[model samples]
Target chain A: MVKTNKQKAGNIITALLLIILGAFMFLPIYLTIVMSLKPQEELFIFPPKLYTLRPTLDNFSSMFDILDNNRVPFSRYLFNSIAVTFTVTFSQCVFVSMGAFVLAKCRFPFSKLINSVIVTSLLYQSNVIYIMQYAVMSKMGIIDNPLALILPSIASPMGLFLMKQSISQMPDSIIESAKIDGAGLFRICWQIVIPNQKPALMTLIIFAFQASWNMQGGSLVFQEQYKTLPTVITQISTTGIARAGETMAASVFMLIPPVIVFMLTQSQVIDTMAHSGIKR
Target chain B: MDKLKKLWCDVRKNRDCYLMLAPFMILFVIFTIVPVIMSLPVGFTNFNMAQPPEFVGFDNYINLFLSDKVFTKAIRVTIIFAVITGPVSYMICFLLAWLIDGLPKKLRSIFTLIFYIPSMANVYTVWKIIFSGDMNGWLNSTLIEWGFIQSPVQWLTDSRYVLGVTITVQLWLSLGAGFLALSAGFRNIDRNLYEVAYIEGMDSKLQELVYIVIPSMKPQMLFAGVMQIVSSFTAGTVAQELVGFPSTDYKAHTIMTHAYDYGWVRWEMGYASAICTVLFIAMYVCNKVISRLFKE
Candidate 1:
């Protein structure tokens, strides 16, 4: 009876700790939801209420109205985000996985040099190269096109390194057996290695989706039609505090897709990290 | 000559491997590799977008060091930002992930989703409302109601409190991919190691973590370390978003924002390239130092 009480006490303490941490983690999100649902009158109330007695959909509707009133319709920005995100994610999955397989399994002259370059590139953020990249893009005649976005993200060094780390764990003997059975290297990569890396692919999808979804043209693509959802949201929100409720609602809209993708695939992603080992 | 011939033959033998690599490598070289290579020469010149680049050889670099007070301030701010956010966020990530490790799987995923949402969602615009400068802002209104302050505090605009607010939001958003990797690292530990640890007279969870968990988690930890260091160093976008660009008196100016100011806004492509080159070198050096620390 005493031992049972001790166990119960421990469980309660753990629950309390988790709730506190969870509250901290969830605070900003909770504030966002409440602020979005608030009407303009309630939004400015002194000692701002955490719980609202009167909630409304006016903010979301106004957000739509504000977006719809723009010269380019709201759907264009939405389409650009979705299309770019899908292209980047799909291409990264296909091209990066293949590159990772070759880098991991096949040995050729200067392979060590190549591998080190890829690893070093992991530390190279895009900020350092943004100007030079614009030059290259202009030279390539892709400055105003969506290709400027899709083409650069295809060779994600982090993705390649991550996929390589996971692929490296494949036993050499399995590849040897496949080689003995006359499987081509391409066949071996697509069939043997790629099929088993679903978890890693899902994780990459989450990352690539977030990044590509958030890709603002910001002088890269000047075409109004090609502008992404984030650029539009920022443009609208920065107008003033008058549209504060609508701004929150729009951000909530922006937040939904990635959250859905993460919810669906997080368990698998955790599993991949377990297997990938990500170490030296 | 014989060894060279053998190497050529081996290269030919791996022709299929080269074929598989060609598509991605072509794009990688064109986009990433060439830009990086060009930044070096470009940094030496005085290039405006319209005029051809005139080689001014070290003038920009010298100006940045000797005359540019903002650049120096940028360096100081970036260092402080990195020093504070990098290790603190890193420890928070590890601690939270460690604590959340053994929860029921459904509950675990829910908590993970809650924590991970901010970084993934790009919901920073919401912070603008919360920290709005006037009485209507949530924080100010609440504080005023509670008799904390008589008037509104300009959280975003005020120079004194700007960096602190940025840091707070940064900490909120900092539990990113590194957090995910660390949490997954805990789950992947061999269960038998703990049994052996206890049998070998490890009396507490703390000892087991030190002797068994951390050593085995070196790889994930290294990856997370590289990630945290990289993110902390380039943390510009958040500050730019929360506070306006060329923020009040340039209070939240960072190395990245400095690069942006010169490169994009000022149209000083060459000068901007120089700034970026400096930042690149600093990051490379820091990464080397970090990897060496992680070396077993």
Candidate 2:
């Protein structure tokens, strides 16, 4: 009877601890949502309304109206973001997979040198070369183009590394068997390796999608059209202080694409994490 | 003759694979590889976009390290921001992961989604509203209502608080990625280890964390640390916007902002590249130290 009581006490303590930690983890989000929905006048009410306030969509409406008058149409920014993100994501996957395949399966001269260069590029971020890149882009006259953003990101080191690691895990006997059957390298990759790497591929897709979507600095430097959602939203916040509600609304809108992508890809991403023993 | 023929056959057989790989290789050379190589030359030249290049040798580097007060201040600020935010954020993520690790799987997923939602949502926009300088701003309104302060504090404008505010936003956004990564790490640990500890009378929370959790999560922690360091060095955008350009008397300025200011705004490409080179060296050294410390 005494042991049972002790066990019950331990369980209660655990429950309480979890609740407190969870609340702390979630407080910032809860605060942001509440702030977003609160009426502008009552937003600063004393003791602050934790609950018990009428919500309004005035913020959302005002944001759209403001976007209508801007020189850079907000919708265009969204389109540009979608275009850049999708292009980078899809391109990175194809290239990384192919490169990984080459490095994994093929015996080629200078492979070690090429792999080292790729790793070096991966470890050193673009911030290291932003100034040089700016000069090059200026000289090339492509400073404000979408290609500037998409092209640089196509050879992602992380994607290549992950894909190589995944591909290396495939059973070599299968490839040997395929070779015996007179199937060429390309046929083996398409028919066997690619099909087997579905989980890793999905993980790469989600990762690439998220990274490209949330990219801030590249978009900042690459486009003058306010042609990306992050750039547009950043501009709004920086320039439109008086229209606080509109800024929040715009931010809310900017967040939807990434959130949807995350939700859609969460399971696959988690599965990849499990298989590879890689943390985020 | 036989060796040459074998090589020929190999090339012919792999031609299709090479074709498949061509686009990436071409783009990589043009974009990533070329820029990295070209960055070194820009550090010695005085060409703005409007003018012809004039080689200036080590003058840019000399001026940055010697005469530029703002550059020095930015380096200091970047270090401060990185030190303050990186560990605190890592701890928050670990805590969240530990808290949610034991919950029912369905509930855990829901909670993960909820916590991650804010990070996915328009971060800059939400932060703009929350940290608005006006009394109408969310933070200001809350503080006033709570009677914590008689008047609204200029959270973003004041040099004292600007870095703090930036760090706060960083902590919030970083929670999801790091937390998710660590949680995945936590889930993969051998459960039998924990069970064994429980049987061996290691019942204290600290004991479990030290012996089981931390040891198992070494790799994840190292990765998170490296990522946080790199990001802290790179992440000056939100702070620049919130704190105002030149960083409120250069108090919140970071190495990234200094490079941007020189390269883009002032059109001093040479100086900017020199500054970037220094920052790169710093990051490289820091990463080396971290790797050595975490080496198995």
Report lDDT per candidate.
Answer: 0.80, 0.70
Instruction: Give me the overall lDDT of model 2.
Output: 0.70
Off by over 4 Å in 2: A1-28, A35-52, A66-83, A97-116, A122-149, A161-203, A214-241, A269-280, B1-23, B98-102, B128-137, B176-222
Candidate 2 per-residue C-alpha lDDT over B1-296 given as tens digits, one digit per residue, 9 for 90 to 100: 99889878876766766776677778777777878997677778896767877998889889988999888888888888878777788787787677777767677766767666655665565566567777767788888877888888888888788888888777666665456556656665656677788889886667899998887677566555666666777768867766778767777788888888887788887777788788877877877787678665
iRMSD, model 1, in Å: 3.0
Q: Candidate 2, clashing residue pairs? A: A46-B145, A47-B145
**Candidate 2 docking classification:** acceptable
Q: Chain B alone, TM-score of each model?
A: 0.93, 0.84
The stretch of ten residues in a row with the least summed lDDT in candidate 2 chain B is: B176-185
Residue-level lDDT tens digits of model 2 in A1-280? 1356656776688678767756755665566556556667765565456653788888777766766567767678677788899999988987888888877777665466776677556556544366556656667777777666777777876667556655664558778888899987778877777666664566467668877887774433544464666665565554453455566566566666766776665554333323532222
Off by over 4 Å in 1: A1-17, A70-76, A125-128, A168-199, A218-227, A267-280, B1-3, B187-203
Q: What tens-digit string does per-residue lDDT give for candidate 1 at A1-280?
A: 1346655775687778878977977888888888789888887676678977689989999888888888899889889889999999889888888988999888887778888788777766544377678889999899989898889988888777766755665668778888999998889898877766665566567778788887777677888898888877777775355676787788788889998888887666454434643222
Per-model i-RMS in Å? 3.0, 4.7
Model 1 reproduces a share of the real contacts of 0.52
